[model samples]
Target chain A: MKIERREFLKLGAAVAVGLGGGLTLDVLTKTKPAAAETRTDVAGTRVSSKALHAKRWAMVVDASKFKTEEDFRRVKEACVKAHNIPDFGPDSKHQIKWIWEEPFERTFYGVDDPYLPEAIKKENFPVMCNHCENPPCVRVCPTQATFKRPDGIVGMDYHRCIGCRFCMAACPFGARSFNFVDPRPYIKDINPDFPTRTKGVVEKCNFCMERLDQGLMPVCVEASNGALVFGDLDDPTSDVRKILDTHYAIRRKPELGTGPSVFYLVGGGGAGA
Target chain B: MLEKALSGSRRYWAWIVFLLLLILVGFLAYMRQFEIGLGVTGMSRDVSWGLYIAQFTFLVGVAASAVMVAIPYYLHDYKRFKDIVIYGEFLAVSCVVMCILFIFVDLGQPMRIMNVILHPTPHSMMFWDMCVLFGYLLLNFIIGWTSLGAERKGFPHPHWVKVLAYIAIPWAVSIHTVTAFLYSGLPARSFWLSAIMAARFLASAFAAGPALLVIFLLILRKVSSFKVGKEALQALAKIVAYAMIANVFFFLLEVFTAFYSRIPEDMAAFQYLFWGLDGKHSLVPFMWSAAVLALLGIALLVIPRTRKNEVILPFAMAAVYLAAWIDKGVNLILAGFVPNPFGQVIQYAPTATEIMIVIGVYAIGLLILTVLYKVVLGVREERA
Candidate 1:
């Protein structure tokens, strides 16, 4: 078997190519069944109950109804309690926030005109993770730890997150928080249902996917009375769709092309008007 | 060859011991950081990346700078650089090791570093950066080791070695370019989003990398029998001077575009760095110092008399090295986050622990460099 150098090299290259191709095919095929199952489950659930299955989750906050500080506090408190987010107190430099308050101007800085209504200008808007259709945080995450779920909710897999904080840097809204310290000690009352995060890894609002699975509204939405509305944006009949259709609403940094799901209703003015 | 590093003077042993002590201190600090979290550092939610990342960015430039010597020597057959090219490669090897360490320490979950490889997101610049950095490290190691061995044997390097060296020329440029892309592609941070980022990075790297190389050669001349020669040093000085000029020019261009446009978003970071933005002026003094030093360094190098004077040359190189380090390693990353996405200034200063960790990484790089230089010099001496 006298094989020339050129022929031998050609044979080696072919074997390498064949092995690489076979390995790629194996990897693709192995993951297909799990993905297919999730897809089927989503489709089956959608067919069984139109109201239960979310194609795109979204939220709307009515600034007019959220008049008092107490009203805003309740919504924040509910979210914090539901998520087991640590409270580093008022003085802590690096506090964890699943939901927090920001002035209206700061919340929608670029969009807001200088001639904004005085009432809207002074109001403290409750801001949280927007769960965008095109999320920069998800794009920058090396691990798909923070990802968009089938329901269009941006989900955080705390266990899988390497806590690189690239997502924190990538999030335009400052929506994500890193567990700079052990979050467990700071958490006053641990939620038995929700697991507390470790000293590393990022955490953010998950749109209450767990609660939704149990046929409950997001804790923030439930606490907001009629101020906060949550529903499937893909469903034409959903409350969020109806509210968005009928009212004048704004999403944060829409120009950034993130397609934020959280909308603000600033139409019914009080002080400036 | 391995025994060469082991047989060194008392000064060499002392230097090695000093680096070891620093490494021990850094290891202890890192242990504390591991037990807690990245919270031990001064980085916050607003300023997420801090000292570690900044150092990583700077060292990557230093690593990429090896191409300055490699290109002139290998591609152009520039005889002057032939003796010193291996030193540049060895310096790159050390810089890369430090860069990798800086990144590892910066990670919130250092144990899960392999997730980057397992997940392999093409969309993420970090994924690409990891690929290039590791590839560049391996390429330099193979080329440096193989070429040096061939030189020792008085034989021409294998054909494959030349092919790898050619591949390395473009690969060096790509490493820094990819690093710039990591910041530039982000839409959220207006300060980093610029077309000139990669170009600016390359210019700075070419200046800083060779400056360090020249400094090392000068030290080697004094302590050892290794002669990098007068012509070699002068040629390297020319490269450093040109690159430094280009780097400063690129930075001035950034300043002009930002201030002239008067887009508050664009000007915010520069304003924060040079002046005080919203009363936060921690970085103001350092940035000014960097600018002044850079100008003075360029002035010294541009003048032939000052550049050629051996006594004046070291000072000029040191000034350029410090200026570039301050600009890239300290100001650049910090300023990018300032006037953060929400147009607010949240100041960050590295903790004692963080600084110690940085010092430790540097010590490790120096130790690696010293050992590598010792071996290469020994081989060359024996052959001579």
Candidate 2:
């Protein structure tokens, strides 16, 4: 909630002076008069487009409920539909890349291997884009195609992506994907409302921007089978806000200081299960 | 035969022809890649960087190797280097030519490379890399030409030539270091996040680049009309030996630090590459091969009898080059991001087109080196 103004100033000063009042500054401003009233499934929150960007979007996953494959698949489908993303058959080269299902028992290569919860005998968390506070992808992109929104969501300007994929390399998470071939071949039915990417552009989860634009909850949140909780970290009254406050939610790569928006609840068993 | 051996043989024509044919095939492959986009390659989401980048990293060492010849001729006042210094400049020219080509095929839009000058990202290391590579390329060309022209006219090298020659030393260091910054600065990939990445890159470049140059020199000695005495190459090889030793030591230091510190996040990457974390065994052999090659190269260079043996030295250098190239390139760069942040492991292999682009670029470099060497060799033969 407290975006350190001093830290922004320090980073901004070292950067090009021409980049004045970018999306970060837009975060503090009010939304347009029109989009001020809309519904999000999270209880105790009604906000405008201005309010949308004012608060950084974040997710809290309660890994306890993700005990079944059905639970994980339900949320994955929901997120995909909400984004209007086409998921081609497995092994299809043109498969529309989106959300990942990480096995629960996994540890950061050499990092901690915490005790496996009883329920998560075959555990892992579903991961999308973290929408990092400091995105390396945005930094390395020569095209400036992938920029972060004011509310801490990483947005893509598909029109601008020359598909250089430097962002793909710069990203530590491997969160980004490149359309190596023509994506249209795989896009069986085009979603006119939500656009598809051209070949040679890099893409990843947009944190369900299309849904956010229409004042609806991200499809992943609705599909999460009570596993995923979405909320504004700035607002203490919201359900996602409440979840983060009540339970000990874990953020990925806490040391990286990218301020990941996705949170994980514990669950999952030993590896190779 | 001895007189011709002292100069350099006509076998240069055969190498030139062979490289040209490879380059032609490579150009055809690149055209196909451009038409189809990168999908022709094995790259997917999990494995982002593949062969193009690997070749770029390797040839960059070749480009940086020019510094060996540059320093002795321009700085240390080693008179013996005069005969081969043009070859050094020519080698840098070709390697850089190849470096730029490898990158050209890797880009999504080759035309957009011009954006570098237009956008001018002062903060981005990539921006700096572009500037350094071009500058290094131009500087080597100018220095080599002027030196060759002076040698032809049977006059002492002009003073203005030394200006560019001296600048090439630190400039050589900058190209590879800046390339290192391309990766080491990325905080997310713990494998490339080490503080000594720049030094490690330089150490590895020193090890591989000069070894390549030494081998090339020996081949030229045997087949070419040009002649290089042992003293000049011994000076270069001695330095290469130390660089190889340092490179191996630095690699060990990273291994020690990763394991000793027990930073699982960092170690996880090493485990995936070296010990096959998550039941994957793809990159382990390449990693071990590089380690073994590094040791063998050091052994050859360290021992006087083996080091002095022409047959053994060239063979040793070849082995060292392969090892270091794989270490800095394929495994070090690609395997860093396996299983991605989302725990999805993606595998990558370069397509034929990707390999072709690599070859084409080498062809272009060879073309440049060939012409430059011809001009220099002509003058040297006349003078002798």
Best candidate per lDDT, number?
Answer: 1
TM-score of 2: 0.84
Q: Least lDDT summed over 10 consecutive residues: which range in candidate 1 chain A? A: A24-33
Scored by DockQ, the top model is: 1
lDDT of 1 by residue, A81-167 (tens): 888888898656578988878887678866667887787788888889999999998898888888898889898877778888888
lDDT score for residue B186 of model 1: 80
What are the per-residue Cα lDDT tens digits for candidate 2 across B1-384? Answer: 113223444566676678889888988887788887788887776677788888888788878668887787778888988777877778888888888877878876666667666666666777788889999999998888776677667788788888878888899999989988888888678888888988888998887877878877886776556878888878877878898899889988999998999966668778877878767778889888888888898999899899888768888888888888889778887877765765545666676677777768777887776666666666666677
Runs with alpha carbons beyond 4 Å of true place in candidate 2: A1-51, A64-75, A78-88, A91-96, A107-114, A121-124, A222-228, A237-239, A267-273, B1-14, B272-275, B342-346, B382-384
TM-score per model for chain B alone?
0.99, 0.94
The window of 10 residues in a row where model 1 chain B has the poorest summed lDDT is: B335-344
> Could you tell me which residue pairs clash in candidate 1?
none
Question: Relative to the true interface, what fraction of contacts does candidate 2 keep?
Answer: 0.46
Candidate 2 docking class: acceptable
